[model samples]
Target: MSFDQLASELQVRKAASLYRGRKVLQSPQQPEVVVDGKAYLAFCSNDYLGLANHPAIVSAFKQAADEYGVGGGASSLVSGHSFHHHALEEELAAFTGRPRALLFSNGYMANLGTVNALLGKQDAVFQDRLNHASLLDAGLLSGARFQRYLHNDVDSLTQRLSKTQARRSLVVTDGVFSMDGDIADLPAICDVANHHKAWVMVDDAHGIGCLGKTGAGCAEHFGLSEQQLPILMGTLGKAFGTSGAFVAGSDVLIETLIQHARTYIYTTSMPPAVAAATRVSLKLVQTEQWRREQLTSLIQRFRRGCEQLGLSLMDSPTPIQPIMIGNADKAMAMSAALRDKGLFITAIRPPTVPHGSARLRVTLSASHTEVQVDRLLDALDQVK
Candidate 1:
């Protein structure tokens, strides 16, 4: 437990090109941003709909702040559950086509609280191999028999489900894989889960504000009913352009979380202003078909450009496009080269991804222009 061991590990990470660092952003969350005193056209943000700095959402936040003041003051079980919080939960339930929805401080807490509440040592939890770190951590902490299936392979999930003899089984996956940008086969997964009598939970953090005709998320996109996806979790900070996360499910599921989810029961509720702002964001997500349309156009344009360049790309049809680079050093070097070319895209290295699957994660937004995407393609071509 000496400090020298920690220092040695840091050195090893830096040597392996796996050390992570933060870039100070001097501007708002948008396509054009100033980071560390330099301006660049950024493609690394999760703001898929370009609503982070939207006027209406910002105005709503300010107005709610003026009325409700700044802090949450207490946990939801206490006096902190504001009118905005309650109203947003109801709206989210309707939007997600569920009986009820409960809010959490963020996506991590939502996942941690929900899984732990639902399962115990007598139960079993199965997750996709490529699930987010939060989901993986939640499963580990749940003290349940944990198993990971092959990424997005329904047969793998079904085979594992058949072998598990736990009293209860829960299968979890991300609606959209954050690193590879591919979507989950929700319909197939749901069918397998139904056959096995297991519950299906989808964390649609990256899919909520970008998919579906009305932007209700992957469940809506796949036309899955509440019974098909019993526990659905989505984050507001991504496409919704606000903060916090929520779980939408049946009344019993939600009530169980409210009572048993330590992360929800202990933490201070999200600020009322964020809830108010997200209310507006939710409305925009539903009404504005153009945002999704624009994102689709950009995704297609970028993919075609990469294909023309003969660059290796993933099977993602979503905004999160990744350029496959096998070596960690090469991924980091390519990211540095892009930064030098007046563009910003992060190199995703292990263990964020698997070993030897390093990549440049290129996220698109409705705020990005065709010309900007072309510039990114040009940079990739030059670096490659």
Candidate 2:
């Protein structure tokens, strides 16, 4: 096939102000970073607890690399499942208060593997309209009867569940809506699912390591038991300052995924070094309550500043605070203006979000100081 159609499609995207570009980070993931050789106060990282470069995690990774080398070298089902991986799985199972946990290469794969492993042509999968792309794609690719309900609307979910006659029904949702930064009403959702005799799964990728008294995530925060929320998926990269993902659930669920999930069965496991480092990161996530406190304090400060400036903000209590800009061009312009002022916040546009709802996604971290947040507010004020 000729490349003419692809070339024209690229041009169309650029013309619509929906084009995306990447900036090279010359430094580590932190508040102050050198991107493409320019220093900027960045607020777009998912390192919520600010442990990406923590000394203890670094040391553990180094030690594990020396012992296990750099790669898994094979799929887990073959020879890649190392001791570090096994230990982390057990730790995660206990952390989430589930009977067992299975590790995946990443959050995308985790969602794909879990959903597909549990559903088929005779099954039904219900997802939130605003779930992460992976979850949506998983539901579509599962060959199940897939339906999307209104975002976090229990009545909508109940109505759909009541009508499905599949052999099995799974209701999936994000513990925290990534872009909007609002939490899922898990309790209400669980109640509704139970009423319909359906299973509930929560992808808490952005909720863990920054939520709950023990940083166990939305499940812990909402006090949902393993039976209440049967399937739980969480990522380590976001707040744990490491890479990979895990699904914690009943023993049967983990075994089912291990036996049937192609994404898990076919892919090489995550490096042992990362698993080792995550063990350390997980400890930090649990023992360090100050990180969550700092995040809460910073979020309040930023929201108060945005209110005073009269900027349209979303109803979010998490680190992600988006300033709503209805036009894509204006949102891009505002992002550029902030960059010019030495602040780096990305403007999220469709099809990542709905059309006419483009906005600047501002993520906070414990590493960010109060002065740095004020500087961001000042830059936003100027741009506005």
Each prediction's Cα lDDT score? 0.96, 0.96
For candidate 2, list the clashing residue pairs, or say none: none
The window of 10 residues in a row where model 1 has the poorest summed lDDT is 1-10
Which stretches of model 1 miss by more than 4 angstroms?
Answer: none
Off by over 4 Å in 2: none
Q: Per-residue lDDT of 231-338 in model 2, one digit per residue for the tens?
A: 999999999999999999999999999999999999999999999999999999999999999999999999999999999999999999999998999999999999
